[model samples]
Structures are given as C-alpha cells and as structure tokens.
Target chain A: MLDLNNIGQRYGKKQVLSDLTHRFESGVSVITGPSGVGKTTLLRLCASAERPSQGEVRWCGEVLSRTPRAFRAGLGYAPQRIDFPEDITGMDFLLHMAALKKIGLREAKSQGRALLDRLGLGRDADGRIRTYSGGMRRRLGLAQAFLGAPDILILDEPTAELDPQTAGHVNDLIFEKDAIVLMTTHLAESLSGRSFATLNIPMAQAD
Target chain B: MTLFFESLATHTRIQLSRHLRSPAIWILALAAPIAARFMLPEQGGDYSIMSINSAYLALDPATIGLQLGVIMAVILTPLAYIFLRAGPTRRQPWQADDLTPARRTAQMLGHWIADTVSLWVLMLVLGLAGVVISLFRLPLSDVRPIVTLLCLCLIAAPALAVIAGLRTIFSTRRGLRGAGGDVLFFFVWLALLLLSSAFFATRSAPPILDVFGFAAPLAGTTTERIESLVIFGPASSGDVLSLDAWSGVMSGDYLFSRLFWLVSVGVLVALFAQIYAPHKFKALRPEIVTTGPPSFSKEPVPLASANGSLISLFLSEIQLVLRPRIMIPVLLIVAAAGVVLPFRGMVGPALALLLTFPFSQQAARWRGMEMSKLSALTPLGSSAVFVRLVAMVVLSTALCLPSLVNITASGATDQMLDIVAIGLGLPLLLTALGYLTRSAVTGRLIALILWYGYLNI
Candidate 1:
C-alpha cells in the first residue's frame, strides 16, 4: 500500500500538485493529466526517482524517501523515454538486472531466455540492441520490469511508442500481475478498464 | 561462409565510414604519424644507417609486434563501443536488425580487423618511404634486416587490435584511460628504454652514436657484430635451462616473453569477446531524477529536512557521471594517450589546448542544460538557479582538482593553466552568449574557433 500526504510540489512559482492527499492500494491505477501537467513528475516521485517539494510518501506505513536497493527490490519502474546501455544484448541486460536483483546466475539465464522467448525476441537474442524497433524496445522494457516480479510496478507512458497490439499485450501483462500497477499515459484509449483509478492533473495557470 | 564474409564486409565498411566521419580523429590517427615521419630528420651516413638497422634487428619480434598491436588496439577499442551503442543514440547509421549480440560482436571484430589492416597499410607505406630514403644514403643490402623487422612490426598489428578490443570490452575504461593497456604499454616502453641504455652503458658507446646501428638488421661490419651479439645474448649461455620458455614463465629474459604476452593478450581477447553481448532492445527505465521543481516560497527548506531527496539527487548526479554513455569513451580516450603524449615535442601545447577546449564546453553545457530545464518549470529567479548550478560545477571540478594539479606539476604548468582557463572560462562566456544569441551551437562554434586561433597565435 502507498499513501501520499500533503503532497505539494512546485516548479518555481507554478504549483503543480498542491496539498494533495491520495492512497494507492494493491491494484492498477492510472495517472492522467493534460500535457505539461506533472503526471510524469508525480509518477517519478512515487517511483522514488524524484522528490516532492512539500510532502511525504509512505510505503507500507514507512515514510519512503530514498530509492533504496532493498526498496527498489520490490519496485519495478519503466520511464516514458527508455534509454539503455546500448552495447549489451537484450538477454545480457536481463541477466544484469537479475544479478542486481540477486537472482542466481543459472536462474537468471533461464529466466532471461524465457522472457525473451515470451516476448517473441528469442530470434534476436544475440543481436545488438541498435537493431530493435520502437515497439520491441518498449516490450523489452516491460520484460525487464517483470524480471524481479516486484511488488510495485510504475510504468510512465508504457505504451506510447508501442503498437496497439503490443500495448494491449502490455496492458494484459499488467492486469495479470498481482503487484500494484501505476501507469501514466496521455492516450485515453490505452485505458479501457476500471481496474485503475485515474488522477487527472490540472494545467498550471499563466503567471 | 559467403554470408559471414558478406556480413563482415558490410560491417567493416560501416565501421570505416564511422571512423572517417570524425575528421579530427582521422587526422590524429593517420596524418599525425605521417607528419611526424616527414618532419623528423633521418640519420645520415652508412654507419648511422647500419647502427639503426642493427638496433631494429636486435628488437624482439614479439616486442615490436606487441607495441604496434597496442597502438592499433587503443585506436579501435572505443570505436567498437561507439559502434555498438550507435543505434539508440542515432549518432551513426545502424539497422534495427543488427542488434543481436553475436552479430554485434562479429561486426565489432570485423571493424577492428579492418582498422588494423588500414594501420598496417599505412605502416607499409611509411616503411617503403623509409627504405627509399635510406637507399640514397647507404647500401640497401645492409638494411634488409631492418626491413625484415619492419615486416615483423606489420605482422603484429592484428594482435594489437585483438588485445585492444578485448580490453575495451572487459575493462572498466575502454580507450586511452584504460589502466590495463596503458600500464602494459608504459612498462614495455620503459623496459625498452632501460634495456637500450644498459646495453650502451656496458659498451661505453658514444653519445653521438650512429643512428643506423639502432635500426633492425644491422648492416656494415661493426654494427652487424653488435646486432648479432645483442640477438645472441640470450642463446650464448649454452644452458637452455637458463632460458625461459613462453609457457612456463610469466616474465623474464627469454624468446618466450613476447610469445607469452601475445598468448595472454589473445586469451584476454577471447574472454572479452565471449562475455560481450549486445542487446537488441533498450529497457526504458528512469534511473534517477537529478533536478526537481524549485520551491517558490521565500522560506528556505532546511538541508536536513530534505536529506533523503538531497542524497538521492547527489547520488543520481554521481551515477550520471558513472553511466556508461559518459564514462566509457572518456576513459578510453584518456587511456590511449596514457599519462601524457610521448612525443610532447613542438606540438604539445597546441594538442593540450585543443583537448581542453571540449572539456570546458562540456562543463558549461552541462550546467546550462540543468538550468534550462529548471527555468522552464518554475518562477524561481534565474540568479539563484545559476548560483546552484555553478556550485555543482565547482564541486565537480574540485573533485577532479587532484588530477588537474598533478597534470600542472608535470612541467606543463603554463599549458595546464591555459587549458583550465579556456575549459572553464570559455564555457561560462559561451553559456551567456548562448542566451543572447539564442543559438547554443553558434555560441560554441564561435568559442571553439576563437580558442583555436588563440592557441595557434
């Protein structure tokens, strides 16, 4: 469970989120806002990647501040614009994430192979990442997030670059997972189910 | 086989294209050597030529091979990394399908081989030029051994590339800043210098010794004897047990030393290549957030209050520096050059200044980018933001101050100071100029050209 109290974040003088309180239980939740609203920033804050100016974020009754390795152990985050270490292969990357997550090498290898196979990237397992399509990269991102099977999954614009089929697949994957799924998206069609509670961010007024 | 060859050929061409695109790097790699060879005067007279030839002949083939190999390795290693990473960044042309680990490794190796071949070809051209020039001053027959030595050097080029590629893949730093390659090259060069000095010191050779005596395949009567003596130094003891074999000994005087190094390098290359796996798709994940929207209220947020976020922000900053994108190439280039350029002769100042120019621009741009991002969001005064940005820059510079100081103390204080001035001051000026001109690239270009002119003057 996640709780936000008095979450007031400002970009200079422009108040983005003002004294807002919210609670996120175990389920899929959608964070929606107009362009330039702090949807991405808010998601980042929850992922422990960003900090709120005047607020407290508590995870499971403890005030979460740092994105501790242990905390990150239970958290899987996917950014809107995905950037990866380009020199490593998709399989290698999964293996690295597995290692970071303290997964056994043998298990990691098998899991990596399985993940790639499941994502239909088995054929290109040995290929360099530079050759992957936008959709494929997005899928790869999803695959990595699922590697640890973390308790909380935060995906920002998860389906932005993906094809509709891939997006649907990702949505299905999110739905199937038992973890807390928090996603931010600009597209309305991407969110069809009420499985997620939406938080619409208002635009900043002109100074 | 055809498919392999076709893939290799296409990859090689792409690698070459990428290398050629960087005109500055291309000039440094190729033209610098050519220019050096032409500018330096050749040792004249038969004795000088013979002495130079003998020196060349006395050099272990493996040692020469390793030296040439290391050079080629340094040049090509970063290129391999860059080539591998080129796709997502869109810095170079790479097809989406080319992202497989095996294909990427094969492509990198092919490219390295191509680079090695090009380097050797250039060496050959230089060697031929040397031969033609030497023929006018001495009997060509006497310099045959030296020519053979040159051939040995050429043969060793591929080995160097392999070694370099392996280092780049496995080592934390790829290019010039890589400790493994740089340290190896350093010890090798030092050993050669010490050995040469010890040999001459024992013989009580004159300071104005003939240059040819040092060349490989010692020709003429006196130099041939010296060359043979040097070559036979290891074999003369008559006890084969005293000699180190390549397989048993890690280090020592023996024919095996060179062989051992080559084998080691080969093993390292194989290991690195095996471990190297290029991903086909990038995992889109935010690692950390460095800057957040600033507080607009007049009340100050205590440092202790936001300790967690502050720490996270600081760690993220450090992580940004550590990220492979920035760290890998920087380390590689620095490693290749080693502690300093060996031939710091006349062009040292110009080279140092030129190198420092980019560093300054990078620092300024980093600060500017952070400020721009922050300014876009909040109504916080630019002055406070600027102060914070400057503090960050200063802190970063402070961390690197030790290295800067060491560089300065190394008898290039003037050059070091000049570099710092240009590197830091120019960037600040450019950042300001960028705001006025509304064009960062234009500001940078003007600053770069101005600095270049200043250095030349």
Candidate 2:
C-alpha cells in the first residue's frame, strides 16, 4: 500500500500540487486532468522521484525518504517524457536497468528479449536508442518499466504517441499487472472497461 | 525584405530573452570586469620583491587597453563557441519559417545581432566598472585612462562583430561543431595573441588582418612601453609614465583597420551562409514500421532473483563515456604523444594532463544525467554512481599508461607516483566538481586553467 498525506510541491514561487492526500492498494489508479494540471507531478511524487515540499509519503508504513533504496527495489516508473541515453542500444539499456534492479544477467537477457519481442522492438533491440523512432523509444520505455514487474508501478502517459493497437496492448499490460499502479493519461476511452479509481487535478492550481 | 526583418526582430527578442535568463551569461558579465580589475591592480601598490602585479599596475593607458582587450577577447571568443555548444540550432523546434531562405537568413542574422548586442552591453558594464575603479586609483585630472578604456570598449564592438560572424560560419560548417572545433579555436586564439604581441613588440601598426583590433590601437599609442608587452610572460620592468593626454586611440588608421576586419568577416559569414543554406537541413524521414504486440503466454516467466551485477553497470558507464567515437582517436593520439614525446621529466606527464579536458567533460555529462528522472528512479541508485566513478578512475589510469610506462621503466618511484596522482586525481576532482556544480563549462574551464598551471610548473 502507498499513502500520501497532504502532499504539496512547489517549484520556485509556483505551487504545482497542494494538499493532495491519497491512498493506493493493489489496483490501477488513473490521474486525469487538463494540460499542466499537476498529474505528472502527483505521479512523480508517488514514485519517490521527487519529494513533496510539505507532508510525507509512506510505502507500507515506511517513509519513502527514509528507505528510498529499498523502496526503489519494488518500484517501476516510466516518466511522461521518455529520455534514454542515445548511445546505448535498447537491449543494453534494459540489461543495465535489469542489473540495477538486481536481475541476473542470464535471466535479464531472456526477460529483455521477451519484453522487446512483445513490444515489437526485437528486430531493433541491438540498434542504438538514437536510431530508434519516437514510437519505438516509447515502447522501450514501457519495456524497461515492466522489466522486473515490481510491486508498485508509476507510469505517466505510457501509451501516448503510440498507435491505437499498441496503446491497447500497453493498457492490457498495465491492467494485468498485479501491483499498485498509478498513472496519468488523456485517453479515457482506452480505460473504459477497466476497473480503476480517478484522481482529477483541477486546472485552477496550475500556473 | 519585410518578412526577413520581421523574422529577425522576432528571433532577436527570443534570443535576447534567453541570454538575459542564462545564469552563465550573468556570471560572465560580473566576473569579466572583476577579473580585469584584479589582473590590473593599483599602480605602485605594495607587493613582494618578485611580484608582477606592481609592474602591471604601472602600465600606461595603451598597455591597459591591451590587457583589457586581451581579457575581453579571450572571454568573448570562447563564449561564441560555448554558447553554440549549449544551444545548438539543430535542436531548435522545426518551424515553417526555417523553410524560407529569406527567413532563415534573417534568423541567422538575428542570432549574430543578439550575440553582439549582449556582448556590447557586457562591455559597457565592464567599462563603467573600469571607470569606477579608475576613480579610486587615478587622480581626477588624468582622464586619459578613462578615455582609453572607453574607446577600447567601443573599438571592441567591431572586434566582437567579427568574432560573432566567425562563430556563425563555424556553426554552419560541417566537421567544426564539437570539442574538436573548440580546441581548434583555442589554438587559433593563441596564434592571434602571439601575432598581436609580436606587432606590439615591433612597434608597427598591425595591418587590417588584426583579429584582435587592440593590437593596432596599442601599436599606435604614444607610450613607448609597447615593446614591454609580453604574450604570457611575467611583467618585466618598464619606465613609469606621468599623466599625458593620450589621443593615439582616436587615430584614423586604427579605426579603419578595425572596420576593415569587421566588414570582411561579416561578408564571409553572409556568403558562407548563402552557399551552405541549401545543404544545411535534411528532410525528416519516416520511422520504421511497428509490428503487432506479442501474445502473452498464460504462465509468465518467473521473476529473477535479486542479485545485481556491478560489473555490468561499470561496463555500461564506460560505454556511455566512450560513446562519442571521436574520443577513440583522441585517446590514441594522446597516448601516441605521450610515447613519442620524451618520457623524461614533465614532457610525458604534460601529455597525460591533456586528457583531463575531454574526459572531465564526458564524465561531467555522465554524472549530470544522473539527476534526470530516468536514471534517478533506478534501484541501483548511488551504487551506479560509485560504479561510474570507478569507471572514470580506470579510464584515467589508462590515459596515464603511456606516461606511466616510461616512469615505470626508469625505476623512479617518485615520478611514477606523480604520474599516478595526476592521472587518477585531476579528472576525478574535475568531474566530481562539475557534477556538484552541474555545469560542464565550469569543469572544462577549471581543467584548462589547472592544465596551464601544471604545464608552467
């Protein structure tokens, strides 16, 4: 379980997320809002990628800040803007991420191949990310997030810039995961049949 | 023509706004004049028996102008390339305006104008600061110092225009874009400085080819102390001069030479831009086709046990640092220089010191990327950073090997230890400092300064 108690985030003089309290169990939680409405901020806060300006985040009663390394062990995140080091091949990047996640090389190779094959990037796995197109890079981002199948998943706009069919496959992968999933997205129709909770960030709070 | 002017105006505003907001620009603006003041202290101030500042302080207005001009020249010359490195036009958003040749010319002109305008503003601030410093250091009756400094600042406009034009051409040219180009420019600046110092020593008016316009102005000054000017040497003795009304700077020869170089460089940039404009941009290509997602098997592969490999992480870090293929040839050349140059004394060690610039920049970039969300979220966390540090140390050691081989063969444990310290220590220090400060330019600048010091030592 993940718990947020009155979390607030400010960048310079601008307040992005304020007094946001939320709880998550093992299920999909969609954060929906207009552009610049702090959905990404909320998701980033939950992933422990950024600390809240005020209040605390707890993962299973352990404060995230206190046990970030351990918390990261069970966390999987895909940011809204996917930025991969351009020089490394997709397979190499995943393998590196796998090593970070404590997956053995032998197992990582198999898992990376399977995931790449699933995402239609098997043909280009050995090519550098610099050569990969936007959609291909997006798929690579999703593949890494889904690498170890950690207990908590925080994905922002995972299906964005993807074809409808690819987006549906990504949605299925997200819904099928037996973990606490927190994500922000614009496509509501994609998640219509799935049982999930919605967190709406009002437009008024944005700068 | 209207559209061109409109585009130029729009780009000028955008670029100027960006310049105003950049912390680097602000830092340079405040630091340049302050550095100048420190370089030229109060005349006849108390100093140690061997100190040069006392002699530098005793310089006439022409020498002072030359010093100020050198300071500004070095700062502004590299700045043109550094700004390009930081903000590459290739990264700009694809706009419809880019398709029109007139608008493209306008955009390039706007960039040049913005650079010149900002540089002029900085020069004015530096001039005012110089005047303020003069008020404290000089008597009110001696305004030649003030006039000389201000006139140099004005003469600097033409010099800066040329520098900005060359920067535009450099940007447009292929194979002259990265650290290679920057390193080349540094040598070019050194050559110009040498030539200018030679002209000053000869007491001859530097012809229209004076890249740094100050050479001609200093040559035309009334003070016979021009021969005492040294390119990177400690201040030698020169007879102290009493206050005299110096009007040599207002001469037509100096003004015409500066104008001539400025117009030549400006025309070259315009012609080069027109010639290369057609081949500059490539059409966006379509991406590869995506296949349908794979069918998921009912029973999934079991999760792998939690046991990360530091070796893999280290290798990936090495790959990241070595990503730019140019570094491969550069490293080979550094090693060759170390081998070909005599291993005795400082020669080999000096070659090893050269590796610090490229490696530190690459390492800083690698560490800088750690702050990003993509890497920060990874479970390896600080362990990955540790692995990268080890990687840098290993690479630094490899760079030292050519120097190390000679020291090792000589049986001089002391020199071997010295090689190891420089090899493993400086790059690590520079890279860590760069990461802490989050500016590759800071690291590169510090490395070069330290490298210069090490060479002189």
Candidate 3:
C-alpha cells in the first residue's frame, strides 16, 4: 500500500495540496480533478518526483520522503512531457534507459524487442526516434514506464496524444498488468471496468 | 514560375524574420563583428596592422582579407546554420507547413540566398573598413578592386556553402542531435584551418627574405624579376625572371587561386548536399519509445572495481562532457587554439584561465543537470553527488594541466596558480548558484554573463 499523511505542498504562500491524507491499496487508481486541483501534484508526490513541503509519504513500510531512489526503484513514472534524448534510435533508447536502470544489456534488448512487438513498433525498433509519429512516441513513453516492471506505475496524461484505438490498448494493458497503476485521464470513458478508484479535484476559484 | 517566385519571396521573408528573431544570429552577425572592429585599434593607427602589413606586402590584401574573412566565416557560418535550420519549436521542422517538394526546394534555396547575402554584406562592410584603414597607413593604391572582390568572395562563398552543407548533414542523422553537429563541425573546420595554413605558407616568400621580399608584390612593376624569382623558389640559379611573369602570377593568376578554393568549397557543398539533402528535407518524427525489456532488473551488475556513488556520478559527468556533441568540439577548438597560437610570453595564469574558459562554459550545463531532481532518484546522496561534481570540475582543470605545465616551465608559476584557483573557484561558485537558483537556463545565463564580465573587467 501507498500512504500520504498530513501532506502539504506550497508554491510560495499559496497551498497547492494542503494536509492531504490518502491511502491506496494494490489496484488501478484514477486521479481525476479539474484543472489546478493538484491531482498531478499528488501523483508526482507518490512518484517521489516532488517532495512534500510538510508531512511524509510512505510506500509499503519504508519512508519515501527521504530515500527517493529506493522508493522510486519499485515505482515507474511517466511525466506529462516526457522529454527524451532525441537523437537515439528506439532500440538504443531502451538500451540506454536499461543501462541507467542497471538492467543486463542482453536481457534488456530481448525484452525491449518483445515490448516493441507487443506495442506494434517492432519493425521501427532500429529507426531513429526522431522518425516516430506522435502516437508512436506516446506508446514509447508508456513502454519506458513498463520497463523494470515496477510494482507501481504513475502516468500523467498518458492518452492525450494517442488515437482512440491506441488509447484503449494502453488502458487494457495497464489493467492486465499486475502492478498498481495510477493514471490521470480527462475522458471518463477511458477508466471503465479497470478495478480503479477516482480522486476528483475541483478547480481553483477565481478572485 | 510566378507562383514559385512568390513562394520563394515568402520563404525569404520568413527566413529573414526568423534570423532576426534568433539571439544567436544577432550575437554572431551584428554584435561579434562590431565588437571585433571596435576592439581592434583604428586601422591606420594600430600596431598590429603595421606589423602584419610589414610581414607580407604582395599578400597584404589576401592576408588581411583572408584573416578577417576566415575568422568571420568561422564564427558566422555556424550561426547562419543555426538560424537557417533551427525551428521555432524544438519538435517542429523549419518549414512545417510547406511539405511539397517544390516548396521545400524553394525554401532551402531561399534560406541559402538570405544567409549568403547576409554574410556577403557583413564581409563587404568589414573589408572596406579594413581597406580604408590599411590604405591610410600604407600605399595600397595599386591594390586591384578585382583582387579585393575576389578575396572577399573567396572567404564569404565557401563559408556559406560549408555551413549550409553542415546543416544538411547534421539534420539527417539522429546521432548528430544537440551539439553533436558541433563536434563534426569542428573537425571539418580544423581541416579547413590546416588547408588555409598550408596555402598561406606555400604562397609566401622564404622566411629569410620574408621581411624585405614581402614588399615585392606591393612595389608593382619594377620588381617583376624579383617577384618571378620569389614565386619560383626565391630567385634560385638559372631561373629566367620578368615583370610579366611575376604580375601574371600575382594579379590575374592570384584570383584563380581564390577561385580554385571557391570551387573546392562548391564541390564540398555539392557533395554533402547530394548525400544529405534528401535526408534533411524530410519530416522528422519523434524517436523515443516506451517499450523494451526492463531498463533495469532486480539484480544489479557486479562491478569489477568497488564503485561508489561518487565514482558513478563522476563517470556520468565525464560521459556528459565527452559525448559527441557541441561541447566536444568546443573543447577541441579551445585546446587546438591554445596549442597553435603564439602566446609566447604571456603569464601562465592568464593562459591557463583562457584555456579553462571553454571547459568551464561546457560544464555549466553539467552543473545545471547536477542540481536536477533526477539526482534524487540516483543511488548517490546529494552531498556525495555534489562532491563528484566538484571532482569533475577539478578533472577538467587537470585536463588543461599540460598547457599549464608548459606555462610553468616557461617561468610563470604565479600565473599558473592564479589560473588554477580561478578555474576551480568559478565552477564551484556556479554550482552553488545553480542550486540556489534551481533554474538551469537562468543559472547558465548568469554564469556566462558573469564570466564574460570578469574576463573583460
């Protein structure tokens, strides 16, 4: 389980996420909120991409606020804008990430190929990533999060650029995977029958 | 044809606007030349002009023109490419809307024309300014207008072609992303430098009579025999020499040499364009993919050597530096310039500082990346990571130690030590500032501005 206790995040004087307490068990959890409601912040906090201004986050039994690397090892996060080294080939990219993540090169290559085949990008594996289409690049981002087969997967706007078919496939894949998945989606239909819970955040009121 | 011309005109206008908007172009095209001309003493009064003019009279126009042209070309060529090729958005192509073959061709031609024109105008103004200045100090009344024009064209055309070719080459390959093009660019540039040096050395009179015989070309008709002799291995025994022979070589034939170089430039551009044009003109797709076998496994790779987070961080820093991008070329150029320039008697500290400047500039991005939240996910703790960054800075200084040693050997220990201190101090300060600021672009900009200010002050 993942737990956040008395968690607060502030940008200057304004509170973004204020003393929010939540617990999530092993399953799919959809973080749904109006714009600026701190859903992305909550996800980032869970991913350990950002630290709480106050309080603490814990994963399983271990404290996550301090030891991010150890916490993130079991978690995979795909940011809203997943900026990558643009020059590398798709295969080389997988290999690079694998190396960074300390995966065996040979095993990573084999798995990379399987993943690409599954995602319908096996033929384009050797091609430079600068040549991949928008939908294809989004799938590529998803593939990276799937790497290491983390227990917890966090995706921010995963279906934004994808076509409906590709989006459905991704949703299906996330549901099929055993990992506890937390994803943010604008389209309510995308989350149907996924064993997921929703946390809706209201938009900030105008002065 | 009318539609094509209109399209070309539209393309030209767009290209010009884009160039004007770019900070890099403004910096290179306007700021650098103005700064150079300003920094250089008023032409007639400067000691450098006197010394340079006295060195070679026949080759004076070529020499001065080449010097100004080459330096401008070297600096501006890259700027031109950056302006011409860089799109508004990082992900978008330069000609995003115009995908048709004819439109694309027109757009490319339009960009080339604009860049060439810009380079030509800048060179012309600077050359005329130089000529006016030089004539005040020395008699250049006999300096042919054709020769001057040829010299300027020689420098401008090649520079434009080479830069255009490079942009084409780099646009095609994914491996040439970021500053990778700069690395390949420097190698090509160095080759050009070598060729220029070889040409200049071969064309000049013997080193022994270099002082007096240098004026032979400038003296005109009387020294025809001497000029021919000089051309054919410096008046060796059994050599028939005449004014016609020497003038033929120096005046009309000399332009041919410049033309030959221009043609070589054309050939290089054509060859590269042929190879790279088709590839470059295509629409680029985002290449990153999300799938693969695990990027990391549950099991870690066993290390041969006991590796600490510091060592890993250091290795990463080195990787960031040596990656075949713009930084590598900048480092190489700095190193090459330091070695080749005749900075004989300068204080070692100053020389060391000069050499370290490029490395420090290169390290700014590294420093920014070091402070990133990405490090929070690395095995290394923040303190250990900071230490590794510090060590990398030290290592960069150490890379320049050979030159420092040469400086020290030449009796400037005090200067060497000063350089070492400044070199080490600047990066550390910049790193701290970066951490405090928490914005990479801001940090880099501040660091660069401060560095330049410090240098000038």
What CA RMSD would you report for each candidate? 19.6, 4.6, 12.6
Candidate 2 lDDT, B1-457, residue by residue in tens: 7787898898878777777777767786788678557655665444211122224434445445545665566555556445544532323443444465555566667767777677777776666666666656666665465665756564577767766675666566555543554555656666766676676556664556567765565455445554353333343453353322234456676667767776777677767767543333321232233355434333343455557677767776666667556767767676656554544445544554556555555555434343355667777756766676788788767766776666666665666655655666766776676566544544564566456545654
Q: Looking at model 1, give its docking quality level.
A: incorrect
lDDT of 3 by residue, A47-107 (tens): 8877889888888867896666676656667666655444446776665444444445556
The candidate that achieves the highest lDDT relative to the unseen native structure = 2
Lowest lDDT block of 10, candidate 2 chain A: A80-89
The CAPRI class of candidate 3 is incorrect
Q: After superposition, how far is residue B173 of candidate 3 from its true place, in Å?
A: 11
How many Å off is the CA of B206 in candidate 1?
A: 31
Better of 1 and 3 by DockQ: 3
TM-score of chain A of each: 0.90, 0.95, 0.92
TM for every model, in the order presented, reads: 0.37, 0.83, 0.50
lDDT of 2 by residue, A14-62 (tens): 9888887888889999988898878888888888888999889999999
Sort by lDDT, best first: 2, 3, 1
lDDT of 2 at B228: 52
For candidate 2, the share of real interface contacts preserved is 0.38
The alpha-carbon deviation from the true structure for residue B99 of candidate 1, after best TM-score superposition, in angstroms, is 22
Best by DockQ: 2
lDDT per residue, candidate 3, B55-173, as tens digits? 22223445445444444554455445544444221223444543455455455455555555555555566666656544543466755545554554554555565565455446445
Which pairs clash (backbone N, Cα, C closer than 3 Å) in model 2?
Answer: none
